[model samples]
Target chain A: MSALPEVEIRIGGIDVGVEHDALLASTPGAGACVLFTGAVRGEGGLGALEALELEHYPGMAEESIASVVAEARTRWSVGAVRVIHRVGRLLPGELIVLVGVASAHRAEAFAAAEFVMDYLKTRAPIWKKEIGSGAERWIECRERDADAAARWIGQHTPTGESA
Target chain B: MLKLRFFASIREKLGQGSLDVRAAPDVVDVASLVRHLDAGPMPGCAATLLADNSLVAINRQLASPSTSVEDGDEIAFYPPVTGG
Candidate 1:
């Protein structure tokens, strides 16, 4: 069987350079490599957000990401898909999630990366709890994200969708 | 026997992380299992796991309400994903 995409859910910092090197190394022949990282914004809800906590469904979380990466691969001419998501308490500016895709062409890489990100936003079994002074609320799924994911449904059927 | 799990706000609302549903002949599919769970031990469970509200996975793979369930299946219920 082919190798499944690299997916991780850990508590700590992610070395952006190290991940870039690994992705580039894996898909040396690819012409374009696109990497996207999501960081905790200091401002959300009300007041200065002190920290963000991510809760994931352990085994299901990894599996969901893999499923979407697999879907991305089927829809695009993709080479490598790497996803890293951090859990537990996180402060503002700390990187929370990273999605890296490598493809033979720039457009493919860009499209696949965005598709994976959009799918992940509305489907993966992960949640963000924003913590601010005397207030904490679980981040609700946004309408924009659901719409982003919806556009892909009819354009091309993403096979192996678990959810 | 079925292993059930909950995460994020669903877990918080359910007041627990996991629950075990005893195997029953009537609990044959995802829909039945969800009905059992909702009407059984943890009430309010059905509200979160409905087709439009939350996501459910059978054995670590995404599943719909009608997906079949077996004795050893691992099922999880959680809200719409908000990750990047």
Candidate 2:
């Protein structure tokens, strides 16, 4: 059985410099690497976003990501997984978060990377406060996120399985 | 007794980040502890976060309502995480 890979979790605004290094180092033994970065957009369907604040349940947040990475390890021949998320005020076009996975093949790497992201969106304890033109409000969980996570329920699937 | 910590928005809303509670032996469970804390001097924001949902962890493990708590254990409460 492949042992669990190194998992790093950092809470900060996204930095390409940091992310690139992590991705490069984690890719050494892996045949494929998948990196995903999520950015804050001007609009989130709520309205025009002026700024956004993200809050997280600190201890639980870290533990949850660790568990997700561990679970991915069990299901695939993964090499390393790094998850970094920024908390605090963010502006449009700014990077919000990143997930990088390394595995023996593109299939495992890509699937595990996407799986970690899907679970993180729904299961992790993070909240968003959107500052928009009308008023600032706590962002509600989207039904889309629930649906995204739901698709992974029982099957050993890949990205192509969904959109 | 256990040390309970709050972080991020929960900490900001509560006005303070950490607290200590003397846990009665019979009340050494997460649900009981949450009930006790809820009845304490937690601020409105902190209280609101727990009104319907809040994440709980016992010693760095995602804890359920039935999770056990013991002396010196660290219990934390906070809002849902949105981090990647």
Candidate 3:
């Protein structure tokens, strides 16, 4: 018998470091932790950016991330996973997302962290509107993100490396 | 009845977040639900129906066009996820 992987998903404006500490505290005997942060860029190809308005389907957004983290646990020896995404109005350079994974080694930690982020981009029920240069528009989804997440779909088994 | 919800640009364009409508016999999946919402001249809905980026979810689960949905289920449609 084994305990389920620890998972945390949050939607709000808060520093990712705060969530990282909480994720680490939840997993005992994990030797490696990988963390990633996504920040609102100060500029875009269209023009200078002022801020971004993030909207999300409340219940669905949380559930989607939970599913993503659960998949990561199945693919790796992940002990704990935390995903924090901020909604509402945000200025340039503000943190918009965070993903952290705790594992017994670096490979699993890195792979699980990236996997969580890739799925979050495409699977989560969230959207972003760019506000800049006297204009605003919804940011379109990127094809590269789908490609990133696709790479994980069939490769459920580890690549024979020491993961 | 099925609760249909929209978010982000779609919500702004539609001028409402949600609407409850009696599900037709064919409205048993997400694709049909989208078609049901497009029953009127909703320009914004046209994008969601035509664009490849639009995503759908039923009962808090990411769903595809063919995903089965039941009465009282929540169906949400939104533009491709941009959040990290």
Candidate 4:
């Protein structure tokens, strides 16, 4: 049988740039890889946000993410999954989160990456507070996020099966 | 004893990270747990802190109101996750 899927979870800020090369070198024979990076925005959506303060349940946050990655593995033939979510104070335009998935095919890699991100947004035990212009407010989950995760609920019957 | 933990905005508002209280007869599930907390020191907490958007987890797993709770379980309440 193939080796167990690789999973990594980081809770603090670290150099995520090196993770790409690391995943490629570690996972031999993988044909496709997908990487998604989320960054903080300075303006627009949540007002003139200067920085984001992310808070998470110390133990539950990591556990929740691990479970999300595990679920992705069951639905797709993923090889290595690395997720890093930065907590504490994060300035605008800073890297907030990274999701990398490697697989033998592009379809599985792409689908799995999206699936992991969708679940992470809704299910993870992390929250964000926007700070800027003498105002600070906690951000709430968007309806679209729940809808995104809901789309994958009944579609887990396998690749070729009716979804 | 049942543990009630709060995070993010709810934690900030509640002014504490967690509280341990004996699980009374009515505190057998998340729904009942909310009721117990609501009637305590933090009045209107169930309405504000446990709003419709609040997320609940039992034993570190995401759970719903119907999920059963027992002694020694950790119940965490927080706002919707915004992490990517």
Candidate 5:
């Protein structure tokens, strides 16, 4: 009753205008589209963050993101998934990344998009250095992110198998 | 000998991305190697990188501190992921 969705993955400075256009244009066959954007906060409470430098293992980062997208596709009857992560120097308030998922219904799209982000936050091999007033510090993985990923560990797959 | 590679913040702190060290006479594990590295001429940043938990990959696969290393193995050290 529904067609397979499209998926796009990129690593660059996310353009809100472009992303909005891409999602709107690509969702004609779908009724629901969900987008998640993560940005750098001015004050992380640790110190006054001047900027964040993101570094990623070139081929590995791409492969990791692609794997997350593939897993999402297998678990949900989703249409499309678009992920873009920016690398290099970024100031506070700048966009870090975006995850967009589209499906015929709201539930599938929303769940899949969240799943993609949760996986990316943990499994992806990307590092960030926070330049702040006191001193620059590399961010450590948060326990909350691990918890989010764990929630999907035992869920039944759309294909009748564990994802 | 094994080659240890560092990247991102770790590399920036150490001021060198890679190093070569002879394998220990007995079987040497990742923890020993890390201790040796930490005892090196580490600067403030280099010390800070190790202060918090770090991730290690032996030949590009996730490895624990007790992972073994043999001659010619490639090891990488990196900070916890912060990417989407």
Candidate 6:
């Protein structure tokens, strides 16, 4: 097997397809590759939004995500994990983050990708603000997000010990 | 000197990313330090760091109210994250 990076984490905006290609390259031997992308959308009262602004702790945000990825690695027999997050003003329909996982099986890839994203939403030191016509407000963290992340607390692989 | 940082709504409410505070000797833990910073009604000056919803990190690690801190430590206070 050729040497390839196990983790590909970047804290900036980039072309999603290109990053996905890189992830695909890193997962040469994996049987399953799952990738998830998040994009800004105007929902509910945000329909009139002009843009969504993101802010993050310079060094802390990246490290926080890496820590979560490491946990996913310890739990699943995954081959690769790729994550990229964007910071700054992003218009509606612009991508915000991407998570990809490659593993020997479909279950592992799907779970790890979901795991990383679930943790990132509530744990990463990044924040979002909605901007509209002459108005701006910080996006509040949703209770459902915390629940989503928390539900995985005691979950484990079928053949592995509890995580 | 210990570096105190703020982010998101807290940074906006506090009006700065970082603060220069030569932490007092009496300040031993995060809770006390947060109290020290929640000084007044002035924007960009005093922050309600002790609020229940406020989150903290010490040297980039998620920290709690009881997290011990010293002069050289880096402490940050921010709101619950909203990143995906």
- Whole-model lDDT per candidate: 0.83, 0.72, 0.77, 0.80, 0.75, 0.79
Decreasing lDDT order of the candidates: 1, 4, 6, 3, 5, 2
Model 2 ranges off by over 4 Å: A1-31, A157-163, B7-16, B38-50
Candidate 2 lDDT over residue span A1-93, tens digit each = 223234433444656666555665656665667888888889965688898887766656667777887887777767767787777788999
Task: Kindly list the per-residue Cα lDDT of model 3 for residues A19-40, writing each as its tens digit.
Answer: 5676677778777788998999
Candidate 1 TM-score restricted to chain A: 0.90
**Best-performing candidate as measured by DockQ:** 6
On lDDT, the leading prediction is 1
Per-model interface RMSD values are 1.0, 2.9, 0.9, 0.9, 1.5, 0.6
TM-score of chain B of 3: 0.79
DockQ of 5: 0.57
Candidate maximizing TM-score:
6
Residue-by-residue lDDT tens digits, candidate 6, B1-84: 888888989887777788878778667999777666565223334346767898889999988999999888999989999988
lDDT score, candidate 3, position A154: 81
* Tens-digit lDDT track of model 5 for B58-79: 7777787788877888888887
**What is the per-residue lDDT of model 1 for residues A23-121, given as tens digits with 9 covering 90 to 100?**
777885777789999999999985799999899888778877888888888888777778999999999999999999876677777778889889888
Which of 2 and 3 is ahead in DockQ? Answer: 3
Better of 1 and 3 by DockQ: 3
Give the interface-residue alpha carbon RMSD of model 5: 1.5
Per-model RMSD to reference: 5.1, 4.7, 3.6, 3.7, 5.3, 3.5
lDDT of 3 at A51: 91
- Cα shift from native, residue A27, model 1 (Å): 1.5
Q: Report clash pairs, candidate 2.
A: A125-B80, A125-B81, A126-B80, A126-B81, A126-B82
Note the DockQ of each predicted structure. Answer: 0.71, 0.44, 0.81, 0.79, 0.57, 0.86
- lDDT of each residue in A1-163, candidate 6, tens digit only: 3243343334456676665566666776667778899998865255587888888898898888988999988878887688888888888888888888877678888888999999989888989899987788888889999999999998866442222
- Quote the positional error of residue A27 for candidate 5 in Å: 5.7
Model 2 chain B — which ten-residue stretch has the worst lDDT?
A: B41-50
Off by over 4 Å in 6: A1-12, A158-163, B39-47
